[model samples]
Target: MTESVPPRSRPGPRRGLTERAILDAALRLVDAGGAEALSVRSVAAEMGVAPNALYTYFRTKADLVAALGDDLLGRLDLDAALGDADWRSAVVRLAADLRATLLAHPGVVPLLLHAGFAGPRALVAGEVLLELLSRGGLPADDTARASYLLQTYVLGTVALDAAELPPGAARPDDAARTAERRRALGGADPALLPRTAAAADVVAAYNGDAQFRWGLDRLLDGL
Candidate 1:
């Protein structure tokens, strides 16, 4: 009976795995091919594990996607409390960080577009934003409204920025892209677009960071 023992089979790839590891692997897949590239099987193969192994961490792909969104939003570094006079700077910093994070992972932007915001990370971020808005002297109802407005602007800006990026893949090319934007906008009918044509040069100079900050300032001023 002792001699009849067969050679031991290789262990499966489930050990040393954590939910964070699974999310990281899944995030890599999203980075490669956008959110549509994500699937339980794809993520399992990505981690060199059985597809069912992923189920241990995430019961379904939806859970994985939702967690991915949370993880991305959770990347924001927020101070616990902002000084009264620093609310403006705090708001600007938060918006800039959000914009930068989304642009850095443009592939994941679609998940935000479709799912809106959810999960603990979003709640945390919301808590901070509400506190900042309150500090800025907005009423409770207006604070809530302004939070939605700010989130919508950041997400929408990221979506448009991602859409306009050149297709060979990834990152910024400000001068070149700005030149290209000028060329693209050059064909406008000056006859009908007199004002736009007059300001074409200014309009063509679309700097996302400067423009985002400028807009955020306006929104805060209004609030």
Candidate 2:
């Protein structure tokens, strides 16, 4: 009698694409098509695999997005880029590099805000920043606070830079929206918003990069 053929087994782990490969594919999808375009199905399609395949690597969309953000952070070399610069210059350059990375991968900026950095290079950046702080004679508490403030400023700035508004939508029509929003807030009841109503125009002025720098400088100066 002819022997029955045994069932074929699935490929082992070494034969399949890695978790890192899956994340890299996901990041590419986000980079090319924006955050709204990234779904596990879409990434799987991009990778020429089954939709359910990515679930084994990234259990959920949020988890995948977080992993992509972490991967992007791994690509940055802030401490190395600074070379032998002084603490202030090194910190400033690091902030600029961080901003550039976010802009280059705008789809991941929101993810970064929600998840922060997690990979090895991110840890290196932090360690070097702290070491520089110690070298610059900062007390531990102040160093910690300064690092927090600097990162917060960078993240907030990049979030705004990556914003997407609907087509044909004016950017809040500054003057009109200021007056409209002010009236909505307290409708000619200046007492409820004395300073705000009196300074309606300045409210719109408070939302751009110039203001971002101005605010960051004020905080840095306070240190």
lDDT top scorer: 1
Distance from true location, Cα of 124 in model 2, Å: 2.8
Task: Report lDDT (CA) for all predictions.
Answer: 0.80, 0.69
Q: For candidate 1, list the clashing residue pairs, or say none.
A: none
Cα deviation of 49, candidate 2, in Å? 0.6
Over the full model, what C-alpha lDDT does candidate 2 score relative to the true structure?
A: 0.69
lDDT per residue for candidate 1 within 1-223, as digits (tens), equals 3668789985554778888899999888877787678889999999898888877678887788888888887788776335436887888888888888878877778766877678898899999999998887889999999999998888888898887644325866666666777898899899999998888777776665667677778987888
- Against the hidden reference, what TM-scores do the models get? 0.86, 0.67
Candidate 2 local lDDT, 1-223, one digit each (tens): 9999999996544346688888878778777766677888888888888776676678787778777776777666764645755766666666767777767677767666776777566777777777766666879998888787778888887787567433222244335545565555555457787887777655655544455567766766676
Q: Runs in model 2 with CA error above 4 Å?
A: 1-10, 13-21, 164-217
lDDT of 2 at 15: 41
Query: What C-alpha lDDT, on a 0 to 100 scale, does residue 107 get in candidate 1?
Result: 76
Clashes of 2: 0
**Colliding residue pairs in candidate 2:** none
